[model samples]
Target: MGQGKTSLVQRLYQRAVARYWARSARSAATARLAVLRQQSQKAQDLRRHLNRVIAVSQSRLALPLIGSNSFPRPHGTDWAWRPELWRQPLDRVGIASVANRESLGAEVTLFHDCAVSEVTLRQIRNTREADLAPFGVSMDVLGFDGSFLSLVVDLPDEAVRGLKRSHVIRLDTIVEQESPLEIFVRLNVKHGPNTEQVVHELPVNQEVNTVEFDLAYTKLNEKRVEKAWVDLIFEGPEMNRVILRDATFSRRPRAEF
Candidate 1:
């Protein structure tokens, strides 16, 4: 049953209680006791109905994770085996390191304060990859003391050549901070003789947030978009750790329903 049905039953139960109270005023003691008992029974029936509906709703939502012929495990030592409810896709990508000591990739690097501990990059594989290549990409970075962390991803000309022009670039981030912090997304576009760099600011409170960069508005010289790179800059107080789960580019932009 849906929420509407549950609400209707609750309303009916309240009406029954009211009717019982009204009749008890003039009825004999035995009759009043019977009326109270009936009201209790109706309340119990509503509670049972609610429980059944909730169970059905949860089962429906979990159908995707609960594959055929296997029982779903709530938690496991392997992170991938854990249930989907606790997984945050954006916090799953990139490469993780401690302080500014480790390089994420050939073109990517991380730097952070020693005080801020535990930074990670994780990737949440989309449906296509989950069924075909069941693996996740992640990076964990830890900061000690106060430090600056930067991530640089090199995008070669060949990489962007075939990319759809109407795509949306999305970044998922989780921030753990005692104070407010400023995060930056810098885009550097390099064409043969021309180079354009743009920086976007993302301010994060003590909350998890998702930021989307719309590339459609970016007037890239379609013919000269030879090479590009994105730099994520983090600057803030000590003990501020940020986790980046996923960064994805999709050709489909969200439309209003």
Candidate 2:
């Protein structure tokens, strides 16, 4: 039989079993009815658990399974790094200072109105059982009362020129949350008076996530690019813990026509 045919037969059998159970319970004697009711309740609980398992399975199956050790680049990769899992010793991987248009690191900065007590940033060695990275940056937000909070990374000089109109920049990372909140990633490049930015919405519930920015469609003046940066903006992050498990960037030039 075909796969669909098998499913149809199984569904029919389930329905038949349900009908028989109902009918048998209805015709049972008082004592038998009590025992049957208990058994039925147990069966219902099992069914509920099974349904939950099915739902979880479907959700997991919906996303493509990506390997942890390596990222597959069908078109071939130009540049890639697992930032949060850096092998080299970083100078300052943590910035606990209150963020508000202030510089955080040599290349990283924070912009926010959150008080010092409300936020804490730390660089931690990934020692947890859930961590997939060797190193990570952890941000504990007690209360984010600011209108805007963003973590900015100034692109290196090489990126300002090496990034071409045909190149695609991809951001891959693992994010953990204390609660549900929407986060936005913005890729910025400044040509002159205008700063071109492309936003990517990151859904927080997924285990593995990636976002790409194609420069071909952007109005960026690649020749006149004076500066470049990337912004990781958090929205409604009050009372939340956000951990960057692993973040990497890969730039791939478009295939030749």
Candidate 3:
């Protein structure tokens, strides 16, 4: 009987030990799962923090670069200044008016074929937050049935005098767009009854913004030159908001070879 009792006691001890080990294994697995969850959350949080820091740094860095003009010039510069759009407020700024009659401050006119019924143009004052000049042109295009939308700038009569073939006309502009649209910039010279035009395709990148007109190639009648003008035309510009942040005109004589 004692031997049987000893055998039973040994069996009971083995079962208790097995149960204890299984429980310990389950507890260890639970602990490992909890640690993994905590680690994953921490990693995600760290990524979010890093992204925020990077955004803040980039924005602050761009601040100093605003309103800065740096162009390469091998020849002596004749003129460099911002367009009339930024120098002062328009006589009429906030209201949307007929493109034909929209007086965009001095020396500039906004013109579009979209019937007076379907076009909207507003001159918005650029807040200090934009880090831009004093004003920007805003256009909301809807049902644009027109063949072309353009802003015409009439150059002063003085621009034609003392203007030689060796001089180059350069235009600098800043445009902010909501949708991608092609823009054509043209410089028109009217001497007597003949008008000669030079067209340039504005770059696709928003930051891209200068166009150069070399007068040497044109057969311009300097003596008969009576008028000068610029055209900014937008093609396929439906349902878009285009902001002209700033524009400047400059001329420099080409370096003699």
Candidate 4:
């Protein structure tokens, strides 16, 4: 028998059993027993019919079973099963650091190299504003040999001047080893030289630190923001590596509370 024929028979048998059960409730006790036996016989016949159909048509079917092995059994029941295609582990390696040379410009590439030696990068979701957030974007150089390391960012003049209110600029740093460090944040506005140039001293021995540059209290003209840059200056000690995990610039509206 074919699959189609077998399915038709099964459906007819089920319908017959249902109809008999519904009518048998009003029948006598002996009639009820006879109806039950007939239903059981119908179920057995259906099973036999399906077996015959399988033997003749050579159709495939799946059956779940128990196993004692570490891996679970495949969802299907086939003799020629290939385990490699469906049951295999996936690689879960992650990237360290990334730099956008195009945006940084060609002239600035010679001064510094963006890398991730002892850090990791990840993508963030469900952020309030932007879709993606950067992780492990900063660098921590040892020995402080480099003379100048600056990041130049181009911005629209309208956005710079529109920032009349105070905002918080955050920089995340991790100190692998101890050394004296000086950090400077300078904002270059449009039609102006350097507006807000503030220098802050880092701690001698600290695990992890977060440096926040508040633009509210500073002498920054938010209405004239055309080109901006951040300069990181390291002073003292000839050997030490600072791991900058991440740096983000976000605006936090002043709270009344």
Give the TM-score comparing model 1 with the true structure, all chains together: 0.41
Model 3 clashing residue pairs (backbone):
none
| Candidate 3 TM-score, C-alpha based | 0.66
User: How many clashes does each candidate structure show, in the order listed?
Assistant: 28, 0, 0, 7
Off by over 4 Å in 2: 1-74, 82-97, 115-117, 128-132
By TM-score, rank the candidates, best first: 3, 2, 1, 4
Candidate 2, residue 177: Cα displacement in angstroms equals: 0.6
lDDT of 3 by residue, 22-126 (tens): 665566556677765775576578669889999766644543243444334335777665555555556776545455656667777778766653666676665
Candidate 1 vs candidate 2: which has greater TM-score?
A: 2
User: For candidate 2, lDDT tens digit of each residue in 1-257?
Assistant: 65545577788999998897787666656547677788778778978988999987763443222233444553667766444223223566555646576553466577787555476776655555554455566778876667888877776666666667888888877888888889899998888888888999998787568899888889877678887778889998888888876666677887778
* Poorest 10 consecutive residues by lDDT, candidate 2: 59-68
Superposed Cα deviation of residue 85, candidate 2 (Å): 8.3
Q: How do these models rank on lDDT, best leading?
A: 3, 2, 1, 4
- Residue ranges of candidate 1 with Cα displaced over 4 Å: 1-102, 105-107, 111-148, 156-159, 163-168, 174-179, 206-208, 214-219, 251-257
In terms of lDDT, the poorest run of 10 residues in model 1 is 77-86
User: What TM-score does structure 4 among the candidates reach?
Assistant: 0.38
Could you say which candidate leads in lDDT?
A: 3
Candidate RMSDs in order: 14.6, 13.0, 19.3, 21.4
Residue-level lDDT tens digits of model 4 in 1-257: 75546577788998997786566645535566767788668767877988998864431121111111122222231111111101121132123332323222211111333342222222211111211122222333433333444433333232244454355544434333445555444444342565555445556566455555566677766655555444544444234444433233333444445
Candidate 1 structure lDDT: 0.50
In order, candidate lDDTs are: 0.50, 0.70, 0.72, 0.40
